[model samples]
Target chain A: MEMFVHDETPTAAVDQREQVVSALAGSVRDLVDATIRSTVADEELLAVRAGVDALVARLRTEQRPGPAGVRYNSEGRSWSWGNAVVGHGNAIAPPLAIDHDTERGRSRAEVVLGAAYEGPPGMVHGGVSALLLDQIMGETASGFKRLTMTGTLTLRYRRPLPLGPVALECWIASEAGRKVTVEASIGNADGVAVEATGLFLVPRWAPLAADEQPEGWRRSAEG
Target chain B: MEMFVHDETPTAAVDQREQVVSALAGSVRDLVDATIRSTVADEELLAVRAGVDALVARLRTEQRPGPAGVRYNSEGRSWSWGNAVVGHGNAIAPPLAIDHDTERGRSRAEVVLGAAYEGPPGMVHGGVSALLLDQIMGETASGFKRLTMTGTLTLRYRRPLPLGPVALECWIASEAGRKVTVEASIGNADGVAVEATGLFLVPRWAPLAADEQPEGWRRSAEG
Candidate 1:
């Protein structure tokens, strides 16, 4: 029954702030990857931990009362820096930008799987593949015009997804009264590595639009 | 064809190191969550950003040759600190500890979904739900005795799962040839919140145990 609705007036300042924070989050994300791969001495690593903790304390001095709930301006420009899939402020989330063509009911995305996403020997984590596919499929189902939740997801890792540039494609496969099925895949230049099919639910509380919605669905800048 | 094999001797030092590193990674993960929740002033945020970036630069001075490929010690003790689902070195990964009852052919996990994992309004991200299920299911399928990859995942979000302490359970439903079916669900103090069924594939290259094998599968100390 509870969901985020960013149907508000546009705020240029908010957008600008997101960009600023996202850029910083990006750096912090890089830091995370680096720290994981670092071979620094135990002494130095321990010393750096002190400084990192200090920075955290400073940043925590003034904090949001709770989680950074999803927000949007009047223009429907929504931002959820805390989202696990596309949260700009979250380093744990893969920095993914999904582009959807609502008219065609298709979507495409590109991202570089880094060291932080490895699972096997040099391959992208299988769980990460599912995470990305679920997000894309949910977005394709919702498109911002309507709210949709993931109902079921099916994934097939046909081959190893190297830790580097990867592409993902998704589309609405079928739809019924309250159930929407989405198909998606992630791959590299060679070919598809992981394929996915998902079923999304349109909560009874939030019904589908009776008429075709305007293209404002692209405001998932926060999704 | 390359995969992580822990069919060797186990090392006590490695386990000790993991415990130490995981403790540090836990602090860093806290820093990440704190940063996202911070509402510091623009001036303070900017100043802190510089300091954070500097620390990152220092850490990046020396890096792993590449992604920290999965490593298994001589004692067959395997440690994969880069896995997105259960890597101890990864701050972005949910600090999940999956426990499997090989005798019962079931698995159980408990974790606190923090701000980084939110998708809907205060609910755990649907994709995160899928991620966790896939990992637990895969582990259930493998039981850490053999290799398994998620072939397909089906999930149903019965309702919202509020942020905070959550529990998950998984078990093998059926198996035929190379396919293993796993059923799982995540919930809080309440009943089930999200239910999942996954089909895991045991590739021909990595077949099941052919004979009585050593009990090297310690159920993932940090799973």
Candidate 2:
């Protein structure tokens, strides 16, 4: 894929940039899974780390002081490159590309877990499950145009989730003043193994008026 | 303090061994707090790690394979040295020593987070809060005599928890077949900052006969 930098004016160039970011994010996600499941020797592991460090150095030649926060363009294109959930540059996140069904008030994503996420034998780590759930639930609560923080999360592991491809589905269960409830689940091709319910809060301190177009706050909140 | 090896005789040694283990656990807990809050330089960090590695080597001179599981004696004394909540030899655990009051169905622990636990500026990491709460709520659900696994946990951070000394309290709210509910909170001495609720399940597959002797299952469940 060709890389396109963001431009001063919103145009097809911006959309192309987003596509490149998405493609890069997908590759990074693949790297994560490979790192986890690699049977490579310790020497190889150290060598790989060095290679990654060099790549990071190259990126640092021109970069911001801190993480990439959410950003959006006038054309309504939003991007988050440092997000733990969907960051295009974060290798730790699964290759999860969430598809928001705005009309249905739901979202779904599919990803595979490999060695890096393993906890017991061949199963995914319990904490990894929680991390994925948090992001998806948080997004469900926000519904693509609002802001929410995870106020609370509940999870139940009905069975051990195998290290393989899985599907995650989430939907807004209910919404109240500053509080949105979300329900989500993760399952293998065969059946569901884990289920979650979460309460997300738009802190009383944050702006409640979705109509108000604040700058950084609105950008971060929307993405 | 002198470390005393357990005696082969079952009768007199049980209580004596328990006392020694408890004292050692206390010292280990202190070490955790010190490690967190220490302003020691990088050289000191390396030296400390080396010292710890040597100690581990000495201990491993004669040992079994894999991680330690809960152990008990014929005299009915039980110990768990690999527990995430109350392990005696685990340096990863935060400095937490929970006190259980059976009569009141309550439990409390005090801890201080430091550089190692920091997430946003001076605030404790969100995952660290979840970890600490999981232990307390799990213990509260177990009531120190029965087994429980965290079936579900929910937390609300009303405000950012500063990385410093804090108090945590948990108590049972209700119970229903194989499920115990716990309510807990963490805060600075002045007031509450985070509150949590948990639903702990005594897996249906686990033995439910509380009337059984020895209580190995119960001891393992507290984590």
User: lDDT tens string, model 1, B3-81?
Assistant: 5545353587677667666766776787778878988876776777787788777777887877766777655567777
Which of the numbered candidates is closest to the native, going by highest DockQ? 1
Candidate 2, superposed: residue stretches over 4 Å from native: A1-31, A203-210, A215-223, B1-149, B160-195, B202-223
TM-score of every model versus the real structure: 0.90, 0.56
**Candidate 2 per-residue lDDT over residues A85-136, each given as its tens digit:** 4554443445367888866779999987654444333455454566566667
Give the alpha carbon lDDT tens digit for every residue of B1-223 in model 2: 1111232446455455444434433433333333333333334434444443333333334443333345565555565544433554333345368998967879999987543344333445444566667677877777766666667777776766766798899999998888888999888866887788888777766655556523444464434
Residues A125-189, model 1: lDDT tens digits: 77788788878888888866677777667777787788899999998899898888889999999
Model 2: how far residue A125 lies from native, Å: 2.6
**Native contacts recovered, each model:** 0.59, 0.05
lDDT of each: 0.75, 0.57
| All candidates: CA RMSD (Å) | 3.3, 11.2
What TM-score does the first chain of candidate 1 have?
0.90
